[model samples]
Target: MEDKRNIQIIEWEHLDKKKFYVFGVAMTMMIRVSVYPFTLIRTRLQVQKGKSLYHGTFDAFIKILRADGVTGLYRGFLVNTFTLISGQCYVTTYELTRKFVADYSQSNTVKSLVAGGSASLVAQSITVPIDVVSQHLMMQRKGERMGRFQVRGSPEGRGVVAFGQTKDIIRQILRADGLRGFYRGYVASLLTYIPNSAVWWPFYHFYAEQISYLCPTECPHIVFQAVSGPLAAATASVLTNPMDVIRTRVQVEGKSSIILTFRQLMAEEGPWGLMKGLSARIISATPSSIVIVVGYESLKKLSLRPELVDSRHCYQRFTDCYKRLYQLQPEMTQRIYDKFITQLQTSVREEISEIKAEGNLEAVLNALDKIVEDRKDQEEPAWRPSGNPEADLRSALVPYFRQQRDALQRHVRKQEAENRRLAEAVVAGRQQVQELQRRGQARQQAWQALHREQKELVAVLGEPE
Candidate 1:
């Protein structure tokens, strides 16, 4: 429903600062020339009854030529030329939509379906009436023939004898059925085209993505771009041919309604009637798809070279700068290392005083632990300087780190010595106290023995004990 394809086309055309419409329109029309004759023949066959005006594609071709001459094959040329407005609109819209969402969409399939359906929705609304007129004109015989239905717009009574020019058809259609008549098969058209576009885009995108693995370096890959179009078109055409037949029936005046048409086509011509002009449609779609896509992409790429070149050049310059930085001389790298070490020394020297004042030798030890923990996690040898500036810087830093390590070890040793002396004194005092207790206990024991002897002696005298 958001059929915003035109937005992207307008943007893309503006990107190159040139008009893409002219080239796009021309390429599309030219390719259409090859397929138009087939299309006309197919349309004529679709509009007729069970083998009435023509039996099949071969018969249609012969009859048109015999009745209308060389020009008979191009009956709808003028109307189709007018119809190109819608065709171009569809193409532009699709391009714009695809371009608009290219960056955000992860799946090519979804993008394709969305873009295709959206563009068709808009373009079909504008062009179905034109399609009506063209098909009418296409189904018409030449001035010389006599057919069962004496329709207007043709010289003989056999052709679309309702009107002459494009305006005449419009006027006549308006006179007969008014506005609604212009959109006679609106629902059928939507059903036919929406799914057709959705199917076409997904198939196109799927094949394009698969093909892209082969076009790594090119922007509008010539062969890949060209081949991808037809493959995608052919696939979509086959799948949607039945809907197309139904749509054609519903649109052409005097044909049955959609439900009745399907039944009639199936009953009269079999299921094959639903695919009446499949080959012709395929032929019509493929080259036109190719031409439109190739021309659009080619123009886009051609205009983008300068910007791409500039970007690459800027990237190269950045790379060069990095290379020079990495190639700095050993002396310069050593100066850098010295400067770094001086900063570290200053910071640590300031923190050392606070640590010492707080009597937190553990803090210094923790800092040393942290420094060791900061070692690189990778197994690669550090700096790897075989004339590498980074390696040279690492080499210069090694001596400073060793000195710091020695200083921290010295501090740890001092703390350990102080701790050892305190432990010795504590042990000495404990020993002295134990000796005193031992002497006291011995004296008490002696006194108690003497008392017992006396008590025994005095037991006879028992009182003082």
Candidate 2:
């Protein structure tokens, strides 16, 4: 099989925009639903004062389950789901920005960082209002009899708000803070998520490139993404946890100033307070990153134009030709001939017709016959050619085959030399290990002899005289 790493990246220009958007939205929704409970848990953990209601993510899960049932975990999910609109905007902006930046910079890391930050800036406009409302809903407690869930900055007095009452939450925010209530944590959101996005993408690409280099050549693309996505997200989440804590507090508690929130949180809960929801955030982000990265890549692959897909397959065929050259399999040779003829027919139908009309077809056939006759005695044939254009073309391609054969032979020789060098190094390493073991044995024997002599000297000196 061809190494998929060699396949070209499916850029935004190559995608069917309509299909990409549709699939992207659907995938985003599905992933959001799957990881939403973690978001709710994280928000609850961040807003609660001094672990009053829930100690950590697992404890939060169990307590919420026991108190309010499964429905408790999905609180505010409906409002949060609206962020899929911003998710689409985020992707669109990221791709466009990355493409635009490509003309100026050659570095993938710089491109990703710029694109991610730009996307986050655009997305936060749509996301912050939703976050404000959903986080309010996230703080709502249904089963207050079990334990009062204390939120530090909650605008809704000390009373418990009913679950799924999005309208009431909106009304309360409007009546209390007016239109500005919807954007309570906008700055904090930008601070938290912009850097989060900016850091996440570059790290993701960097880790993926490193992993791809370290892994076997045949490793699948999806596996590389799965391993790299979570690692990048976890790193980003840890770095931005403090900002995230501040953002959640501002949105849920209706805090006015980011500076005030930070100072108060530190004064009340100390430095560790900034990491209140770190675990929940990491857990939530891991699968979310994996799904988003894998789904985005898959969407790009599935939405590629027909010609691009064909070109990709052609590239794979060219790479596979090296291996097939070594085996000289008749079936593989036939497939290659068929593929070549198909490409020729597709690409040069008009030229072929022009040749036939100009009465040059016979001359071309005679030239092909002459080439075949000249090569007839060169070597033993792998397969007899049927009388067809494909067969004739195959027989005429001896020079190309010879070139490929020479390159393959060189590669094999280089690999063999590397193997020999590695074998010699292994033998030398084993000899060094043996020498160390002998020295260790000698030291052990000397230490044992010295201990015995000391014991005799002590016994003789202490004889009851």
Candidate 3:
């Protein structure tokens, strides 16, 4: 009891609500970006279910590059950024509320706890629409038959999708439900966020306090701050997993409520449906949050006086990072595409080899022709003449008849062999042409995807002005 009181007293003295919020949000963004690839894998796997979309993380990633050729993995980033901003606002509000409560109330810890809980509720309200958009965008498959065009290519912008892209999806929702369509899962989102974030932040603070008790006395408050943010994020992720699954389906499919989604999951996949992607979410969320927090905190610390760091400098740094990443993206995508194509080619070549080895009739005829040709040089004339000139002529004439018969037989066999070979060659040539056409189509699709991706990247980087 005494120790608890002492820890509370220390917490009251040491905690800075504003700094923690900024630190936490910064960390969140950093972690989110770093693990963006993993999150993408998880989303694809979830959408694919039984399909050959991807086998596992690595296999799916390889397949994405091979099938859609690289840009396919990051199709909805624009909407994602918008969604992330919504998430950040939630955290920011939570911190501000905590600070307000702490300042107004003598019991800082209790007020902070209340503030955190309420903030989650508010943030959920704001974030659900964006979440709806993001999930709808994520669940799409290559060539899944959306609207009219049947989009194909990469998440960067091709493969197989319904005609309506992200904007189209939004329009459909609006057409169906007006503004309300964007908030289809509002109730479920609130329910999930309130308990999830409320539990997460307080639990994180408690854990950090405990860790601090065990640490050396000389360390700064920043270390504890860093440790607490990740612990909070991870704890929230695991505890809220069922809700997340519910949330994802609700947002993407735009079903009724969380309960309906849950009921559907239970009916289709039993109770495990609620945990459909817990492993992936946990794997992606924890470390990703940690990285985000650590990097953000470090940057915040280094950039501590905004006046000195300057908004211009921050923008410049971000621009440089974006530029470098954008430049490398093509090379990275190409490497992945090349690797998958090589695998697919190997598969195709093996199939062709098997067909040819099955003793194709053409092959057999060609072998027979070779055998006959070898015997041609060794044989003497079929007819010969000797003694009297007239007798020799008659005898030679007899051999000529025999030779004609042999020549006729050989000619018939040769014609048959030539015909068979020609047929085989024709089939092989047709296959090659078809394969080339497919490759050409894929390349054209890839070029368009690359162009669109570049445009988006430029937009995000804000183009020097």
Model number with the top TM-score? 2
lDDT against the true structure, each candidate? 0.68, 0.79, 0.60
**Candidates ranked, most accurate by lDDT first:** 2, 1, 3
- Model 1, residue 198: C-alpha shift (Å): 1.6
- Number of colliding residue pairs in model 1: 12
Q: Is candidate 1 or candidate 2 better by lDDT?
A: 2
Order of models, best TM-score first: 2, 1, 3
Candidate 2 Cα errors over 4 Å, as ranges: 143-164, 315-465
Give per-residue CA lDDT, model 2, range 1-465, as digits (tens).
456454344568888888888888888888888788889899888988897888899999998788667777887787888998999899899989989997897566888899899999999999998988887777767523221123332244323344436776777788888999899888888999999999998889888889989988778888888999999999999999999999888877778999999999999999999999899999989988898678777788888876777665654444344443424543344445456657777867887788899999999889878888888887533334453444454564665588789999999999999999999999999999999999999999999999999999999999997
Residues 1-465 of candidate 3 have per-residue lDDT tens digits of 111112211122223446655665666666566666566666655544343555567776786667655555665555666656666666566556766675567454566567667877777777777766656665555656321112234454455433347767777778767898788778777776677756765776687779778767666655666677767777886677777767666666656776776777777767655655555666676775455445544534453443433332332222232343324453332333335446667996886677578957577668768877876786432222243435533443466568889999899999999999999999999999999999999999999999999999989899686
Q: Name the Cα RMSD for model 3.
A: 38.3
lDDT per residue for candidate 1 within 276-389, as digits (tens), equals: 887778777877778656766665544443545344333223223234432444234334444754676798898887888999979779977776567667543333336455
Give the runs in model 3 whose Cα sits over 4 Å from its true position: 1-31, 44-62, 103-112, 145-164, 216-228, 291-465
Worst 10-residue lDDT window, candidate 2? 145-154
Candidate 3 TM-score versus the reference: 0.52
